[model samples]
Target: MSDPKLQEKIIDALKTVQDPDLHKDIVSLGFVKNLNMEGGNVKFDVELTTPACPVKEQLRTECETKVKAIDGVVQVEVNMTAVVRSTEHAQPILTGVKNIIAVASGKGGVGKSTVSTNLAIALSLTGARVGLMDADIYGPSIPQMMGIPISSPKVGSENKFFPHEKYGLKVVSAAFLTKQGQPLMLRGPMLGGIIQQFLQNVEWGELDYLIIDLPPGTGDVQLTLTQKAPISGAVVVTTPQEISLIDADKGVKMFQ
Candidate 1:
């Protein structure tokens, strides 16, 4: 005879499990799908928001542990799958890119680019395909920090510029085209045009994460990128200061 009471116990256990990102129990969020219990073996599948989720393994382990603690449950099985969601403004050029994360700051000299560079390196170290785009046209520094040979992007078919590769990262920076310490001298419209080319013309194939180091402050480049690119999210870097906090608030509001 089947024990209906045991099924309730299994579900109750799952209710206690929460996703770190969503901060809600997986069961209530409808992540625990197609659950079935046969004898003492409980089997189910977990559909994550994205395959690039950093804590996917942790969630799976928690689910297994919670369900296996049930008195009558002997074996627990979980199948993992990912469904990547897209923004309404997603562009075709970024079709293969799984996630576009922009690192910005309220003002300059706040180490925004440094944070973006190191974050990309850290993600690459984890065996993920990572790319870094220095969106700071007037003061692009990723080329120097990454030690990439100063060279122009090579043109691929369909007028796409191939991204420069270094340290297992695909990188694109305006510094590659202009000499060190040279000024861009471009107006706002021109700056927006350049940023668009970087997004639409760069051949960044199938990256797990594209880390964009946006120029500090809420400016033309930031506004252009936000409007033209399907940015999955933003990271605002700010030091402990009153002025920086105020500027950081503007950055946050721009996204909202």
Candidate 2:
């Protein structure tokens, strides 16, 4: 059903296209998938590491150009897709979530929630399964920022609850659990307990990226979350000022 020599030629041509980030050829990275051939027609999928890859289109174009250059190739079909790589967690919590990203800062007013909201939406726009959690107990603002109505997550059997689905993100927020305009008079211990509860009780199923907007500061909220869950990575936001950077440094150190 296929010509051996022609297949070899196609493979060789594809080897010239290297992934800018990984610095490896598509063939070597095993990005080429579902390759099918019929006489002069060649069709294949270019599976990438992340859906939001910066050079997705460039890689697709390069793949098409190289395949079309093959002598016997009369037609070329290259589809770009992504499968996000995940980090290994010691604990089996959030088993279905592939990546858990934390958005943090040293102090308030640094726009941590703003970054988290946009980052989660941006990843979702790339066609990846994404979730957003507002871990800021004292001042939960993700609901308003995401335009998500304040509502409780759906409770399932056995103390589990499903996160609210909106804007292509499975969202959970502290604001959803309390009355509007009411201050959270929670003590230090309660803060950590809530974080653990959110991590263990909420049902965030099969997400490529679960972005958690951590409350500003290196306090109970931060400690509770980091200890209870495996953070794949963190993005610490801050301003150029010395005061802001000092707190940002502390936030970064907390994750380390």
Candidate 3:
């Protein structure tokens, strides 16, 4: 037989569970729903903001831990569900993407592209659907580092391009579109247009993380991406030198 007072203790326990992404407790966020208990058995559902949430497992574990800590709890079941929340400026081209993270650096020598490529690959290794876009039109190096042969993207319906794959990471880069050793000789407007096409015309389907490697320093390409795309966050890579820190500050401010 279940004591009515145990339900109060269970509810109190759930209040301690937090959803890191939402920055709120699961109970306060209304995630602790359909809670039913009989004897020492308890079950409930934790609805998340997205199916591809990076921290979904963490939240689930915390919820179970909190409930199982209740004095009368013998069995705990946590059901998970997702209802993806859309941004106000969400575009049709990025419908399937759950999150976008831009990797930038203060200067060219910094390992921004290397970090971007490996981050995408690491995420993919974790069973996440990941995509990497080389926004460094003038010095795209992801294809070379990933050892993907230079080739153009295939066109699909509505003229969208399908991204290339290497090591389970989906990739799109200006290097693939340009001839070897050819410089991207163009003005700011032309460069912006090309960046737009790279983002909007690529058929990136159902990705957990879309990592964009921006060109070194904050310039026309960076401006175009920040203004035109729905960037969720930015990762500024910098060296220990004061100069690098100074420029990295600028990159951070640009995103802010």
Which of candidates 1 and 3 is the stronger one according to lDDT?
A: 1
Tell me how many clashing residue pairs each candidate has: 0, 0, 0
Order of models, best TM-score first: 2, 3, 1
Per-residue error at 70 for model 2, in Å? 1.6
- Against the unseen true structure, what C-alpha lDDT does each candidate score? 0.87, 0.90, 0.85
Name the better of 1 and 3 by TM-score.
Answer: 3
lDDT tens digits, residue span 1-256, model 2: 8898998888888899999889999999999888889999999999998999999899888888888988889999899989998889888888988889999999899889999999999999999999999999989999899888876677898879888888989899998887776677899999988898888888887889999998889899888778888899999999999999998998889989
Q: Return the lDDT, model 2, position 224.
A: 78
TM-score of 2: 0.97
The weakest ten consecutive residues by lDDT in model 3 span: 84-93
Off by over 4 Å in 1: 1-16, 20-47, 51-58, 70-83, 90-93, 125-128, 179-183
Instruction: Tell me which of candidates 2 and 3 scores higher on TM-score.
Output: 2
| lDDT tens readout by residue for model 1, 131-229 | 999999888889989998787789999998899999999999988777666777888888898988988889998887899999988889998988888
RMSD to the true structure for each prediction, in A, is: 3.9, 1.1, 3.5
Candidate 1, 29: how far from true, in Å? 4.6
Better of 1 and 2 by lDDT: 2
Clashing pairs in 3: none
lDDT (tens digit, per residue) of candidate 3 on 1-256: 5577998898888888777767778889887778888888998888776565688788888878878887878999998876545454545558788788999997888899989988888877766788999989888999889998888789999998999999998899999887777776777788899888988899988887899999998899999988888888899999999988999999999999
